[model samples]
Target: MQDIRCGSCSRKLGEGEFISLTIKCPRCKTMNTLRVTRSEPVCPSASPIGVSIEQTHHPVDRRQTSYG
Candidate 1:
């Protein structure tokens, strides 16, 4: 609920900027690769990165195949 601002420029980030960035803290002005909390997905928004989806299916394919 807080506006994450750019410390060096003192620019209060707008909503579009906030969603694009990953880090939010005072020292971010000078620091690089700060560990930021994973952001929760907004309604009707894209999912997080590095997520793998696994799909499981029954033995239907094996049963349908005939001997060759």
Candidate 2:
């Protein structure tokens, strides 16, 4: 991966949470993770792959709730 300057701030997004991110210019720090569209030369005829996952884990309060 190449070091890219933030399009908005022109600062190097070289710190935490910035490395190897695919969406949202790493420095400007936006919330949205955008979908990467296909362009010629880089990615030809992009085939998309997506997955839906549901995870269940015990909450911090492991005590039984009335609802449960």
Candidate 3:
């Protein structure tokens, strides 16, 4: 099963145990905001940054060439 951890105290919480947008860490008593994603779990205090990528492909000539 997947595990959810408290960001403030690193306490382990059961998956889907968090039912609201924010939760208090039972161990540390620190207020933490939850952010869940399909690819990865994100830190609440983190911000998103923009990214860009470019790709190119070149084809090789297969024809035989004559030499003098």
Best by TM-score: 3
RMSD of each: 20.2, 12.7, 21.9
Runs with alpha carbons beyond 4 Å of true place in candidate 2: 15-35, 39-68
Model 1 TM-score on a 0 to 1 scale: 0.23
Candidates 2 and 3 compared by TM-score, better number: 3
Per-candidate local distance difference test: 0.37, 0.38, 0.50
Error of 2 at 2 (Å): 1.6
Candidate 1 lDDT, tens digit per residue, 1-68? 54555544444543332223433334333221212345456655767544332222122122455688
- Candidate 2, overall lDDT? 0.38
* Model 3, TM vs. native: 0.39
lDDT of 2 by residue, 1-68 (tens): 34434545555544342312433444445422212232345355555354322212221333566873
Clashing pairs counted in every model:
0, 0, 0
